[model samples]
Target: MPSRLLPPAGPARALAAAQLVNALGDGAFLVTSALYFSRVVGLPPTRIGLGLTLAWAVGALAGVPLGQLADRRGPRTVAVLLAAATGVSVGSFLFVRGFLPFVLAACCYATAQTGLAAARQALLAALVARRDRTHVLAHLQSTLNAGLAVGAAVGGIALHYGTRAAYLAVFAMDAAAFLLCALVLLRLPEVGPTAAPAAPGRGPRFTVLRDRPYALVTLLNTLLLLRMPLISLAIPLWTVTRTDAPGWLVSALLVLNTGAVMLFQVRTAAGVRDLPSAVRTVARGGALMLASCAVFALSAVDAPVWGAVAALLVAGGLQVAGEMMQSSGAWQIGFDLAPADRQGQYQGFFGMGVPLARMLGPLLLTALVVDWGTPGWLLLGALFLGAGLALGPAVRWAERANSALVSVG
Candidate 1:
């Protein structure tokens, strides 16, 4: 690992440790869970898919209110509790016998996981300095990619064995990881309520929800976030179907992404100091994504084995570079634009972009980039560019609105 990839020893290290433990479990579980549900639990793929979709929907809706709870109850405390709840949720999967039990456990799992993310962000805001928060977040993201890689390697062992016991063991390990994460989080200092409880009727339930500029920010961030599925979905599908590149290139591409992020995320984040820089970084990222899309589309052109491989490798490099920039810039923008006292709910709200991207990115990208081919890639790229271009004006609108509110107060 590069030294510049993460922050030095302190609370940030502790936070990274907790994140690593949690992600290790998640990577293992993710590799094994669909198989476990189908084979071990005797549920069909359709039921498993439906259950997960419902779970994510419930989880997405729960984020803001639970984040607000973290703000009220002390973020560290809430984070710890939610981590434990995640453990309980995963453990419940052990005895799931039918679709109903599976749905219930899945919902619990998603809700706890979502709430834990929000709570941890709130705690991070309280623990870390404003200027350092995005850098630390980059460290956390790097740690996540590293941990997931390791855990997926471990899960490969279970996948090879293909036994009920092997699947169960993965679940057990995942549960233990979240439980241990709860304990690790206890070492962090507490942060009290960010703001006093508002009197009834004094304000909206979620001020973050009502903040139109923030909502626009989240929407644009979500647009930029199409990168998430680009690697996991668009590239792989495009490779096997549209391009002559070998199937193994998929794994190679993934390795490039994870390794690059693990080494360069913090370095990329170091350049983004405030809103303007974050915006420019994201815009640059968008441009790079457009270039990557063009290269990927070109790979589909008639080419020899080595030529196709070379194009794909170059495209992968460009994509990962854009991914790092977009992630780093979004971290700062999401944190910087939010009110300090509302960091929890605001982060939770901003975090919606992730799930939104997850839910819609696949369907949209598959239709546009994979199925539609060259034009689809170009359209996706242009969408990203438009979002990047729009961000500057949107942010300016946000600043003016915020200033007016401050003047009114």
Candidate 2:
């Protein structure tokens, strides 16, 4: 089968480098966007939050449909198109300030982001064997985090100059990065459609939801993901209102999280590559997230600057651990479970869940935090803990089902 596509570490590194560049640009934009909205455009946090929600919703809904299209045609072509579109969308923010204009730009960026993600993942699966796919995915994700760390540092410096100037700078960087990604993507080979017919009676894609273990894992991991939006929204607000911690602290938290991912993700994920052990790993990761939430929740109550700083550090570590574990387990399972021809759609479906959570989690959690304070954090902790514990049985079922599939194959 064409000597098993992803040649060796050398080629993989090249692909990964390209991905890192794109991620760096995305990181810069992400850090700056909200600040630009609030400070420069004079928009409220609520409007900024709504814009993010709508953008993520659009991204999630587009995943499977875009995956289907990529499968029918080739992922490379779609990847190039998506990357170019992302550049334009990000660049448009330089000119647009009104809510409608911003929303349109966000929609464009979201759609392109979703398309690129599905295509790149499908590209990797097409190029590599199932066993290697997990490793590659982990490496790719880790590198992306590293790039983000670098990007955010640069973005911070840029923002110090002026918010509008910072947005313009990030826009340029993002556009350039997308262009580079498109160029790299064009060099890759195509992976065609699944072996099963796209026509009906081949069973529906939604049937994948019936895989009880996979579904539970998704749910469990998602609950742990609460830390992301919580930290993203709350910590900054906390710094502003509760503590005298400087803006650099927020940047530090992000750096800590990304740096941990870059350093430990591969080593940490390597041991859990197999299906049997991945479940245990995910469960442990969930525990880490619960711990992180507890730290965050407690820190909310009359914390000193140093204490809050310590909390941020602890929280960042826990977040990286959870992200590493869940990312590894998800990649391994998705690669193993997917049919030879359906990798694109499978990965696309897996990815859709995150954006869906991002869409709903922010407003809900933020509002709760506003109304309840410490009680809100306590409730979030309980929810995450329950989700983590619940994953055990689900993982057990998935492992058994996975074994059955292997036997049949």
Candidate 3:
């Protein structure tokens, strides 16, 4: 890659490279996992869904403990181990012959993936400056989008060929990606022996569990993360069922989002310096999302194909922009509010929202945004706005409760 294309040659790029690698694997898995199980592994869709749901739930529960391990031992060592474990677990899918085996493998895969996510965040918090973590994460997210797009394309090719060999190849590639991700991670230095556990654990091993304010913040963030499913589920479903726009628009809107993030996420993140700025940015992002919901509602109206396309495009743009803002702000807040030594556990707890969102968002959004139509879209937007606004008070509460840090907001 050109120098301009690379993040400065350091842990940031190393992290980005590792992210891109796993994202490629994840991309392949996301595109083909369902089809592979149904067509080749011989599991029903309902079983597949149930197994994955169970797996991610297990994974979400596993995150904090794993992260605490990272803090106890070392983020780099734990991250590398978890990365390799994820590769092995994903590879386990190739041997799965029944739902029981599949569920077991899926659980292992999800747990390792979830743990790796927390470990990586812990590593980022350890290696990157507090101020720059959000920007680095932005770059990682951009790399993730790029890698997923390419991996999805690879999966698409396998689908086009419609062969068992091609399908297996996608899984194989995905497994390899995580293994390669582990290798990339190995190049980075450990963030040192984990700082001695704060005061040798005065309370619960995972204090983050008892942290009501952080939990509240995570909850609100999880609500905002509904936009995540909105991207993957609601918008595509809405486009297909409710709008007159062409089918290709489904993909185009996704591309618009991916491309926009790649182009703009870093720049968008530059303004968020601390908790207060993060809060304001999130609020503004919420308003943008509110407007986006309204625009999407317009697409359901009786309009020319072009008009609907325009509305969808406008909505998509606003949604992505809002996504960039909230994501950047959330990253900063997740880091800024945590005790410096407890980043691993804090990040682990904070990241629970992701798996939770993945588990819950689809079912919830399908009911609210897709099935309910325009009314649902508006209602969901209101939910987003409300959540974004709630973060301010939640952070205030967190700041007051967390004695290790001063209330910056």
Model 1, residue pairs in steric clash? none
Q: Write the per-residue lDDT of candidate 2 for residues 60-96, one digit (tens) a residue.
A: 8787777766666776677778888888888888877
TM-score for every candidate vs. truth?
Answer: 0.97, 0.85, 0.96
Compared with the true structure, the alpha-carbon lDDT of candidate 1 equals 0.89
Q: Write the per-residue lDDT of candidate 1 for residues 107-141, one digit (tens) a residue.
A: 99988988899999999999998888888999999
Over 1-409, each residue of candidate 3 has an lDDT whose tens digit, in order, gives 4543456679989999999898888887898889999999889999998999999899999999999989999999999999999989988888999999999999999899889999999999888888788878888888899989988998899888878888888888988888999999999996775657657546678878888899999999989998888998889999999999999999999999998987888889889988999999999999999999999999989989999999999999999999999999999999988878788888999999999998998899899878888899889889889999999999988988876545542
Report clashes for each candidate as comma-separated counts.
0, 2, 0
Q: Candidate 2 vs candidate 3: which has greater TM-score?
A: 3
Colliding pairs, model 3: none
TM-score winner among the candidates? 1
- Cα deviation in Å at residue 225, candidate 1? 1.5
Candidate 2 colliding pairs: 6-127, 194-341
Question: 2 or 3, which is superior by lDDT?
Answer: 3
